[model samples]
Target: MAYQCDLGNNQTVYLDNSGSQTIVTTASGSPGQQQQSSNSFETGAWTAPPEMYRTPGGVTLKIQAQGGDRWIQIQGQSSNLSDASSIPLQEVSQVPGSSQQPMQPMQPMQPMQPMQPMQPMQPMQPMKMGNMEMNNNPMEMRMGNMEMRMGSSPQNTGSQRRFCSQCGSPVQPSDRFCGNCGHKLS
Candidate 1:
């Protein structure tokens, strides 16, 4: 069966109900001048085109029903619509096997508090030294009261040679006297 309605400005809407699907079509002015659009909605798990109808003012209205998911959506399009006009009159989504609750309008949010000022940082004092000596080789560092040094362990040059303390002369390891000054090297 089909139902028909006149929409003032020479426009007519036709709704055809047959089988498990319903189709809605609109025609305006003369048959040849009609900017015709049609949509169909079905009752089963099968997919169908969304239902759309346009007013005489060129504003299009669309509706979609998902029979398997149990959700319905409605939207409108207009040339005068603003970019920020996004809040739908009604919206719904369903999660399979979960309970669903109706939606409520959101409340106005409270303003945030101002941030606190930061405290100034204290300056650090430089380290004091009585007498400090620094060397590049092995990097030796000495403070007046303390010493910090880094180097490898002392190594043996060769046979243990000795020096005569009285005349400052080189002495062999087994020498009993300085060979040049004859100083007794006990």
Candidate 2:
């Protein structure tokens, strides 16, 4: 069984009973600058009162045993062992034959399957403009008598092409009325 006593100002005392021997440890200071000291002795050593133990840093612990209970008092403070500032040390372990159960192990996870490849996209249908049809891939437009193909070819420079202002369809230079919508051309 193990017992602990907290003496405020970042200092604590621990007592562990290991059958024939008893271990006493004193720990002080903050987390990054901590200092600890421990001493072990026969369990019969604490059978009497006023037993003094000094730490490495010059702090002293005054231990007393009374009525089958052990009490601790820090030196340089108060000499009274039963005062309110004094703390009693006793066993802190769980009682025997408790109903608490142990934890179980976790199971392994299954592996994932790879994703299937995506299908290729289908080609789009040609769009219709007044009386013309336009193929978007190569940029070819066809109307009544004029057909315009836009690309790196020099035969279709697009300078001789004329379009109706109203219907936006290709028209010849000599035509007076648009063939697609019959709109008057200037």
Cα error, candidate 1, residue 98 (Å): 42
Runs of candidate 2 exceeding 4 Å displacement: 45-74, 77-85, 88-186
Tell me the tens digit of each residue's lDDT in model 1 across 1-186.
344545557865554434565555666666557566666666443244333334333433333334442222222334433332322221123222223444677999999899888886553433435576665455556554344556754344554346787986778767898999999998
Q: Considering every candidate listed, which one attains the maximal lDDT?
A: 2
- Candidate lDDT values, in order: 0.50, 0.60
- Model 1: residues >4 Å from true position, as ranges? 30-32, 44-186
Worst 10 residues of 1 by lDDT: 87-96
Residue 81 CA displacement from its true place in model 2, Å: 3.8
Ten contiguous residues minimizing lDDT sum, candidate 2: 94-103
